[model samples]
Structures are given as structure tokens and as C-alpha cells.
Target chain A: MTTDSLKYLWQFALLCLLQVLIFNHLNLGGYVNPFPYIYLILILPISIGRIQLLLVGFLLGLTVDVFSDTGGLHAAATTLMAFYRPLYLKAQSPREGYESAAVPHIKTFGFAWFLPYAALMVIIHHTALFYLEVFRFSEFFHTLLKTLLSSTLTLAFIFLAEYLFVSTRRRR
Target chain B: MRNVLLFIYRNHVFFVFLLLEFVCFWLIVRNNNFHRGSVLSSSNRLVGNVYELNNNVTEYFRLKTVNEELALENAALRSLLNESKYISSGRKGEVKDSVARQHYTYIPAKVVNNSTDRRNNYLTINRGILQGVEPEMAVLSSEGIVGIVKDVSKNYASVISVLHQNSSISAKLKDSGYIGSLVWDGRDPQVAQLMDIPNHVELAEGMLIQTSGFSSMFPAGINIGKVKEFHVDEGDNFHSIDVELLTNMSTVSMVYVVDNLMRMEQIELEEQAQTDDD
Candidate 1:
């Protein structure tokens, strides 16, 4: 694999480790458990194949599940997040469209574009995660709180992580 | 064959997503099974180890509060044991022999992970199959009944909390002795809906509600909640009673798993009777 692919793989592992070890334990009053691992999916290069993206999402989620002991709740939710990521990207695209090799980061897309993009992905991921965790529609509104609160928190953390790690330099 | 291949190539991304989702759903369904031996759930060794490690570090902060609660419960239990009137009743032959035979044992567990915000909330406890905790056992806090054990691994177990939509506990009015089913409406965490009580039965606001012991999971007289509001519909025969649950589900740190000793025999006899009728 190229150094760039190797770097992405390392970043993926770091995200999973942070999630299971720290974020999984951060249960704030049993209401908020913000997942920052979606940042890994967010930062993936746009040039990656759709099939590869799905596989990567599955592997990323399964790794998180293996540590947290949540069975496959994360796996299913993250896979759905990956599936919709492309559609969401297309919908939020600029008038001229996105560069093929460009990674969607706060620095690259600006907060105006990246904020809504990350928020939507986080919301979708949380919705799927909470609903599947319950596995029933009877408590649609109750599960909505989990989706909303967690999405908000996850978005906050993702922004913080992006601001701290992602560089402002343009791709060569 | 060529057209089909083209179709597969064209919509391959969607197809891959569908297949991966299916696999994930299968994993979720398979792990939800209580009797599965090969499954690695939250209660399994690896996951248990991580939770335990975290608990060890975090538990120190809550030590004083947990100790105080435990001490209060201990005092209550001690007082109950020391009461001569209860023992005297047994000596006077007032208590039935069968009443003495019925035993409900409790296994104490620490709540490692709990959630009250979800539509269906599940609590993961430190105690599991290794500690004699099995699926279908009743879990409760010091104040009230919590939920039923849904799945158990070696060192951990997950409980289907009473706040869940699918959770229905057999409960009754303590003073009037009118039984009903207690369920959550997914709106308020502090409140649950107690339905199926006939309207004719008189129920004032703030009536005490407790377990009816109709089911094998929870024993009779376990405190569920108290009625906060009730209204009888003009056409319907049942009363819509909103109950304020005694257990603060959000903050519960410790719980007891209730194991009915005679559950197997009771289940077997019930199954046999049903088959005989068929």
C-alpha cells in the first residue's frame, strides 16, 4: 500500500481505539455517548471506490464493536452512514463540484460546508444506531432524543478533532 | 447473462451496502439470542475486562454515595430480620408451609452501563452467568424494580429496562388490589403508563403500585411506582393511569438480580398444560 493508504489505515485504527477505550466509557448521565469514529469516515479521500468505502465502514464499525461488546449495533449504523455519505456529499456539493482526490475536512471545505456535512452524517449515524439499538418503532420519539443529543455531541467533538488535527494547506 | 452482469456493475455500490447491512443485522440478531455459546457480547471476557478496568478507575468517585445506600439497605434488612412478630407468625402456624417453600434469591450487581434516553433502554451489569444470573431474571434497584435480563455472558448481562416499549410488568394497586399491566410510552423517563385496569375500580390519585407476582420474573410486593394521574374514558372500560416510577432509572448504579428458584418447574408445567389443551 502507498504511504497515504498506510496513513489512512493508521488513522482508522486510532479512531477505533479512542472510541472503544475512551468515548465508549463517556456516558454522561446515560444520555450522551458521542462517537467520534465517524471522523475517520469523514476524512477518507473522495477518490476511494464506493464498494471500498462500504467495506471500510464495516471493518471500522466491527473493530469498535469488538471492544465495546455492543454486538453489531455500531457495525450496522456505521455501514448505513458510509452508504449515505456519497449521496450527502453530492447534495452538498459546490457549484463547480468537489475535487476527486480531495479529502472533505474543515480546512478544505470551510466550516460553512463541512459543519452541515459532518452534522448530517453524525445525525444519520446516531439515528440508525439508536433505532437499531432499540429495534422497535414504538418509541420513535424517545429514540429521537438519543439521536439528536448524541448527534449534537458527536458533531461538537468531530469539529474539535478536525480543528486540532487537520491542516489548512491545499493538496499538492 | 451479459445484461445481468451490466446491471450488477452499475448498481454494485448499493448492492454492497445492502449485503453489508444484512451481515450486520444478522450479527445483531444472532448475538441477541440468550442461549448462544459462541457469541461475544458485552458480557464476554474481552469486553468485560475493558468495562472492569474503567469501572475500577471511576468507581472510587462514587464510593461514598454507594456505601451510604448500601448501609441504609443493610439497616432495613437487619430490622426486618430482627422483627420478632414475623418469626412468631411462623411459630403460631399462621404462615402456610407453601409460603415458606417459595424462595426468591437476589444476586447483587453493579451497573456498568445504563441508558434511559433510548426507545428501548438496556442496562449492562457486572454480574453475569458466572454469578448465577440468567436471562429472564428480574433486575431492580434499591427503590424499585428495573427490568428483566435479556442476555447473559460469562461476566456481564444486559437487562431490558422497564422504560422500554416491549417491557410490560404485571402490577397492581397496593390498597385496592386491582392488577394491571405497567408499560412505558417512551415520553417521560420518570413516568410509565399502567393500563388494563377496569374503570369501575375506584383509584384515587397517587395510589401505590407494586408487582402482582403474576409473572415468574418479579416477586409480589416489589415497588414499581405510584399513580400520578388517572382518567377513565367515557366509552372505554379501562383507566389510563400515569405512574411516577420510584426508581430513578437514569442514575441507578447498583441493582439486584432476582432469581426465582421454582421458575423452571413453573414454566414446564405451564407449557405442558398448554400442550394438553391443544
Candidate 2:
């Protein structure tokens, strides 16, 4: 496999492991479940194929499901987020357009550009996941509150990880 | 046909997305059904091993609490031993030993993975089919009822915790004998709602609740919780009761899987009665 593809594969594995082992156990106030695994999809190279993106997203989420015993909850949510990523990127593209090999990272794009992108994606993923899990509209507002809280927590973790790792890699 | 093929080729991403989502939906529906075994759960060989390894590391931090719980349970068991109780010699043989047969057997297991925050929570334990654990068996901690086994792999099993929305345990008040179905409201991990107790029943705070044994899953008289609060709604026939569960689900690590030896016979007779009525 190409180096880029292999790197992505390693990332996929690491993120899945981190999610199942640590993030899934973080039940802050029994409401916020921060899923930073979606960061893999967020930072994937801008030029990655749409089909590949969806497949990777599905696989990553399925791995999490297998560990968490949540069936297809994560798989469905991640796939939905992956499917919308390209369209979101297109709509939010800079006037000069993205660099040829740029990955969507806080390092590449400033906080102003990256914050909204990551936040929206996390919000969409968490909302879809929590709703699909409950599978009912009876507690709509309650679920929405949970979704918002979890999304905020997830966004915080994602930003923290990006800042920590990306800056260190740049220094090297 | 050419136009259709062109259209399909133009939007293949959407089609793929639809296909994957459909598969995921199918899986979710299938997994939701009771007693339907699936390899996608934590009880799978690989997933179970991963959790077991993680538990090995975290288990050290919980050793103090675990030891305390074990000691309390040991003391309780010791108190129940024949040596600790003074039995009247005259009435000892009055109850024939042959009449009292063993009905439930408990197999001890360690919790490998557990979650209490989710709407539908589950726990994975180390014991499974290989250890005589099976679907529908009752799981209990030293303090009180834990959950019921939903699926079992060879070396691991997944339990549907009492906190789950689908979980409903048949329980009754210790003093007044008022039966109700205990269910979690998905809001608090420490409390659950007991339904179907009529308004006329004299309810009081701190009243003990225990399993009714109406269902064969659990033995009767196992403590579930105590009434924390109760109120009758306007024009309502029943009282809304909140129970403070004795066992803290989030901290439960050691559990026992209860095997009902006569479950098949009971089920067979019940099925026969139903069929005869029809």
C-alpha cells in the first residue's frame, strides 16, 4: 500500500482503540460521552475518495460498536458524517482553495476556519448517534440536551488532541 | 438503460451511503431483539479479550473497594451458616430435607466491561456458556440484583443491566406485599421508578423492595431497593414511586450469574398450559 494509505490505516486503528478504551468510559455527569474518534474522519486528506471515506468511517465505527456492544449505532452515525464531509468542505472552501495535499487540521487552517468545521461535524455525528440509540422522539428535548453537551465535550477533546500532536509533529 | 446507468454512475456515493446505512439499520434492529445472539457485541472473542486486558490494568485501582465488598459478603454468608445460627433440636427434622430441593445455582463472575450512562446499558462479564452462564439467567452483586444475562459467548457474556430502558424487574414491597415493575427513568443512575402499585396501598418512604420471583429469572426476596419517594397523581389509580437502588451499578465489578435448574420444566409447563387454553 502507499505510505499515505498506510498512515491512514494506522490512524484508524489508533483512534478506534483510544475510543473503545478511554473515551467510551468517560461518562461525565452521566450525560457527556466524548467521542474523539471522529477526529480521524475530520483530519483525512482533502483529496481522499468519497467512497474510501465512507468505507473507512463505517469500519472505524463498527470497530467501536464491536467493543462497546452498541450494535450499529456508531457505524450509522460515522457513515452519515463521512457522506456529508465532502459537501461541507466544498461549501466552506477558501477563496484560494485548499492546498493539493492538505489535511483538514488546526495547523493547516487557523482556529477560525477549523473550529466551525469540526464543531458542526461533531454535532451532526453525536446528534445522529444519540437519537439512533434512543430510537424515539418522545424525549426529544432531553436527547437534544445530551447531544449538545456531548458534542461540546467531543469538540474540546478533538481540539486538544490536534493542538498537542500536530504542533509537536511540525516541530520535528 | 444508458441514461439510467449514467445517472447511477453520477451519484454512486449516495447509493453507497444508502447501502451501508441500510446494513447498519438491519444490524441495530436484529441486535435489539431479546435473546438473539450476535457476534457484534463485546462478548465476542476479540472484544472480550481487549476488555479483559483493560480491566486487568484498572482492576488494581479498585482493589480496596472490591476487598471491602467481598468481606461484607463473606460476613453475610458466614452469618447464614448453620454454625452461626442456634437451631432448635426438636424442629430440625420436622421439615424433611428431601422436600427442599436445590433450585438456583450461582456462578461467580467478574465484570470485564460496564457502562451506566447510556440509555440502554449493558455489562460484560468474564463467565459465559463455558461456565454455565446462559441467556435469561439472573445476575446479582453482593448488595442486590444487578441484571439479567442477554447473550453468552464461550468465555464471555453480556448482561442487560437494570438501568436499561428495556429492563423491567418484577418487585414488591417488603412490608405490605404490593408488587410493581421496577424500571429506570434514564435520568439518574441511583434511582428507578416502580410502577403498577395501586394508590390505596399504604406507601411509606424507606420501605424495602425485593424481587417478587413472579418471573423465573430471579429468586424471590432478593433486595432491589428501598422506596425513596412516592406520590399519587391527580385522578390517578396508582402511586408514582421512586426507589433508591441498593447496588450501585457503576461500581459493581464482581457478580454472580444465577442458573435456574428447573427453568426448562417451568417453561415447558407454562407453554403447555397456554397451548391447552387455546
Candidate 3:
């Protein structure tokens, strides 16, 4: 248990650093800024408590916010994503259901299962984040285009990260 | 009461989520307001230090362009010196007129962190309150105006960039002297809108736009941009003008923070006049 907590802490710190130092600086085509730090929440143990998940998401977002100078925008978006995570998982679970100690990873769940799950999560998070940052409905379509572009880039990066880190031989 | 408690306990996750969202919303609204010093911003010591460290690594790659920009600005400043130009005046002995009295002082600062793609972009500078930096001071790159200081910490300050949605600067046409409010339209980083110039005023493509100095934040005649295109609406009396900003906000790494020496006196007198009228 101590090792598990320590690993998560390290992951959290690394994600925040990667986001602030690297990803935040990427402004591809002046529209897409891939934010893949929310992958921290995505890879948490499926059975983690909801309240704990929410708090973790909020803290992760706040860490990014502190460095990016975007006050609370990420926090709100990540929290909303966390709130829907369990529902999405339950709705998409197989007939046999997930293992008690299962984690959400491409290697653990296979690419087919992980793709839609990660896409949904990334889309929700990006939509909420972009809209909140813009803070108006007047440019709804423009914001939507930006959100979609960023979400696609973020999804691609998340998958790249998953493939790079999660060993393929460790299938559950 | 027991039933109510059970219901609340059963839905504690939703309630907690709502509470956290509310807190975040409050923070966003507060941060959107100008001049509200908040610790969560990048100007905070921990974040500022991290950005400074990152900048230290990336700055080497940009040193060539930065050096050229500095050299160009130095030449411009050198030309402004009294000794640079041959004065035709035969009887000049250190004229101490009020016009010669310095009304602005500049503090050079390094841009540690900056962004341009975001709708409300901000630049974080290494100089802060320790270096006499304060909120509402004007920031300028060597080429043109950059932003206004929004918050200051001990060793860093965050500037609300001219590209921001809430940013508006009083600007004028250099030739016509028609003043307008310069604002970013949240689309293009290089282009900003100059609003409220009357339709009858003669305008031309590539006309120079400059600071009007109506506000205490900036001095008169600071080059902002040049007119890219302008047209009046079918029934409107004002011409909607597009200005191509002179400063490339994306690559601006060195800046100066302007401290208006007469700002306090001007504001105080204006307030007194208002009170008298009331």
C-alpha cells in the first residue's frame, strides 16, 4: 500500500512538471494546446473512492493552474471529468465486469476498450476547460473547434504515453 | 432528521463535487477581475522559480535574436540622446523646462513565462515588488507595447498581455490624431481592433497607430501597430479598424516596466474634481 501511494505521488508530480514545463508551451496552429496531465485521473485504480478521486483531480488541475497562471479553470474541468468517470465506467463495463483491482490502461484493458474510454474522458475535460476559459457563448463554434483540435491532440499524446510506459507483456 | 442525514450521506460525492466546483468558479471570477492579487497565479514564488528555471534552459536557443533586438533598441535610444543630433539653437544652456522633467522611469525585466494562444494571455516577468514593481504599470517590449502588470509577488510579476480579452489601451492614428480604444478580438495574436474612430476621419491602409497617452498607464506616441484594414458598417458612424501589432508577442522575452511618476497626482486631482462637481 505504501509503495502504491508513493508511485501515485511520483506520477502526480511528474505529470504536473511535464504539463507546466513542456505541454503548456505547445501552441500548435494557435488553436491546439494538448493537456494530457488529466491522464493521472484516467489511470487511477478503477475502485478508488469517488471523493478521493475528485480531490486528486482538483489538486492535479490546481497544480497546473498555479504554473500556467490559469486560475481554477483546469480545476473545474478536471473535477467535472472525475465526477463522470464512475458513471462512464459503469455504463461501458463488460458483462463479466472489471476486476476488483483493475486499473485503466491500454495494456490492462486492451486498445479497443481503452480508446473510447480515454476519448470520452479527454473530450469532456477539454470541452469544459475551453468553454470555461472562454467564458462566453458568443463564440461557441470557434471554441468548439479549438476544443476538438486540442482534444484530438491530447488523446493522441495520452495514447503515445500509454504505449510507451505500459508494458505490453503485462496483460491482465 | 435521520432520513435527511442518510440522504445527505448517500449523496456525499455529488455534494463534495458541487462544493469543489463552486470554489473553483469563485476563484475564476476573482482572477478575471483586474488587480486582484492571488497566490494561485504564476507570480507566486514557487511557480515563478520553476518558470525561471525552465527559461534559463530555453533562453540560450533564443540568445541570437534577443541580442539583435537589444542592439536595435540601443541604436534607437542612442539617436534620442541630445548629443546625437546637431541642435541649431545658438543659445542653449541646459534648459530646465517642465517638459524636460522626467515623468516616467523604466525597470528592465526578463520575461520568464509568456503565452499568446490563450484568449486571456499573461506574461510572467522575473522582476517583482522587490524591484519596485507594482500593479497597473505599463510593460513594453523593445519594439512596442506589451502589457500591463496585473499582479506582483516578491520576485515575480504577471502581466496581462495586450492579446487578452479584457485588455484595452487608448490608441490614436499618428497622422490623423484620431483616438480609439485598442482591444484584442481573441482570434489573432498579431491583429487587434481599434474601435470608436468616427467614420468621417480619413484612414489609410498601413497608417500608424500609437498610444494616445490619455491614460496614466502609458506615455504618448508609443507605437502600438499600423492599420491593416478598416471599414465602417452600413449604418454605423464608427469605423471598425484592424491593427497589426508591432510587437510579436509570441517571441517577446525582454521587456521594460514603466512607472509613471505623475500618475498618483493626476489621479488624485481628477478624483478631487469629480467630487467638487458632485
Arrange candidates, best TM-score first: 3, 2, 1
Candidate number that wins on TM-score, 1 or 3: 3
Model 3 chain A scores worst on lDDT over the 10 consecutive residues at A163-172
lDDT of 1 by residue, A82-170 (tens): 99998887776779877867888778767898888888888888888888887778768767877788889889899888878776664
Question: Comparing 1 and 2 by TM-score, which wins?
Answer: 2
Task: List TM-score per model, in order.
Answer: 0.84, 0.97, 0.97
lDDT of 1 by residue, B128-196 (tens): 877999888999899998998877887888788898767899999999899899998766788999999
Query: In model 1, how well does chain A match by TM-score?
Result: 0.93
Q: Which residue pairs collide in model 2, if any? A: none
* Residue pairs clashing, model 1: none
- Tell me what TM-score chain B of candidate 2 gets against the true chain B: 0.97
**CAPRI-style docking class of model 1 based on DockQ:** acceptable
Candidate 3, true inter-chain contacts retained: 0.70
Real contacts recovered, all predictions: 0.53, 0.70, 0.70
